[model samples]
Target: MAEPAVRYFFGQDGTKLAYRDLGVGRPLVLLHGFFSSGAHQWLHSGFAHTLAADGHRVIVPDLRAHGDSAAPHGAEHYPDDVLTDDAFALIDYLKLTTYNLGGYSLGARTVVRMLVRGAAPSRVIVAGQGLREVTGKGGTVARYLRHVFSHLGTFKPGTAEWKAEQWLTRTGGDPEALLHVLDSVLDTPADALTGIEVPMLVVVGDRDDRDGSALALSRTVSQGTHVVVPGDHTTAITAPELAETARTFLRDQ
Candidate 1:
């Protein structure tokens, strides 16, 4: 399939976000993982191309702090609610009342949160995420900090070497921002999951480092279907098998 041209838009808070519009079926919105842009996760992964080829209108966006989006100055600026609001804003901006939603890792967490908050889509796909693990002790902020510090010197800001840093900085990488996002994720109300009425697909890689947690989360959704594909977390999004499985699920829905 030909690469779909990407378009840009502003979220409610005025942060610039970019996404790709592909194919011609039901709208399928794809949210990418933290620190990774939509292009890197969806476009580069070949997932977007495949979905477009399968006739699904794919909408892949760079979340507020990542990719072509404008990075604001504080972590608090990227709170879960704000992120959810961004999704809604995007949908409204596109004049889409209902569509399908999916994401990987942090992106998946965002999808679940949006669902909990009543950001209803036609169907939802939670890929490469296990909320059970995320809601545990550390939450996204602590885990991200660990990943950042551990991988320190491995990436630089600005150029490709600093992609993660660029994202972090864009979202206002101060201590306050970290605490805000952490608290939001850890304290997400339980009633949120129980209220969702749409079909849900929980996907994870069999060989994922986070498999145990992902499985635990899949069990939480009231009307969820689980699929274990081959490969690790990153590969799960890029692998042809996983992409095809997602396409099938969306089509069946």
Candidate 2:
């Protein structure tokens, strides 16, 4: 059977954030990685459709500045808490007291922040992010500028350029907002992960850059499980093993 797509929008500090909903029954939100929209990460993944097939409703949104969502022009607009609030707003807008959550890479980072802030879900699945030191390189401002120039005249929406654009957009394409988010990522408090009690499954590819960190994070969480699939960062998304692993985890939950 062909899956149906539902369009919806929820307010994020007064601005509308767009989302695509599919399937029915229990709600499961899927967050995409740093340089990709929810469509590319979840819908294109076959993961979204698969979950829908199994009687799970999926909510996929392009974070604040990515995809077809609103892109405000300020640093204050994209802070970690603010971004996390957007996710919560969507949940409340849907009137769901609780649901399942999953994300990859940057999306995974947000899920961790959500968990820290007490946005507890029935179960959580994080891909690409594990445990790693939040190193201090330069401030968020410097990183944001670097991102903008790095992708100048380079990335478009739906090709190899897509990844580049994804990173550039998150950095805000504006210097101030870029710096703000970078700083937020670097300066995030350590206590955030000290006591995550929700059940979690952290999946990483054997060759993924964050493999070691993912394992470390798995160990840190009180109830976390780690799975390793074949291939590197990008390939892991399409790898059969990853799909199977995700299916098993979500089904079991």
Candidate 3:
């Protein structure tokens, strides 16, 4: 098959968003994790390719402030639920009434927000995340965000912010914008994770202490399924088991 083509669309706030399109079937939109983009979490990790070849049109977008998407560093640009709006905009732009949706880490947080907002997707995949993080217990993730914000609009070597900036440089990202993205959605109600009727999968690694326990998160939702794969938060994104598990669940549906 030919390489997928990149497409651009404007968010509700007029920020330019980027996505990659592939295959032909029901649309499955996947969002990437923090400090990562569609290319990093899905394409490079082979998750997007797997879904597309599985007979689904995989649409993976770089959330605002990440990847090729336009990044506006100010808080005004990242109002609460901005990411959620962007997700819905993509779905609406494609005129997809029913589709699959999912995200990893920060992306999973967006999925939770979308779900609570009543965004309807046939199925949802929550990867490399746990209830604790969604419930506002993101100790480590919070620290990283704090570090980034502390040095926003400037650079200090050997810090988390510095490392993230370096990575952004490599990816052509907007570090200030990404930091604002983190600050924007740092708090979500714990009750939001419960009572989701849509088929949902919560995936995390056995060794991942980043977000507490994934199994507990699954139990809270009526239709949630938990899959414990090997590796930590970072490794789970690329872990083959993660893809296979999600693919199986999606296929079963």
Question: Worst 10-residue stretch by lDDT in candidate 2?
Answer: 133-142
TM-score of each model, paired residue for residue: 0.81, 0.81, 0.91
- Number of colliding residue pairs in model 3: 0
Q: Indicate the residue-level lDDT of 53 in model 2.
A: 76
lDDT of 3 by residue, 139-186 (tens): 676676667656655776886577776776677766567767776785
Q: Flag regions of model 1 displaced more than 4 Å.
A: 74-76, 134-141, 144-187
Model 3: lDDT to the true structure: 0.82
Q: Compose the digit string of candidate 1's lDDT tens values, residues 1-253.
A: 5566768888766777777788788788988886677878888889888888888788988776566666666655665467677877888889987689998887787888788767778888888877564455325445666566356467654654366555556544443333344444533454566667788888899888677666666676677778888888757887888788888888886
What TM-score should be assigned to candidate 1?
0.81
TM-score-wise, the better of 1 and 3 is: 3
Candidate 2 lDDT over residue span 40-133, tens digit each: 7788878788878778888998776666666667666765556577778888888887589998876787788788878879889989776763
For all the candidates, what are their Cα RMSDs to the real structure? 4.7, 4.5, 2.3
Question: Judged by TM-score, which candidate is best?
Answer: 3
lDDT of 2 at 191: 56
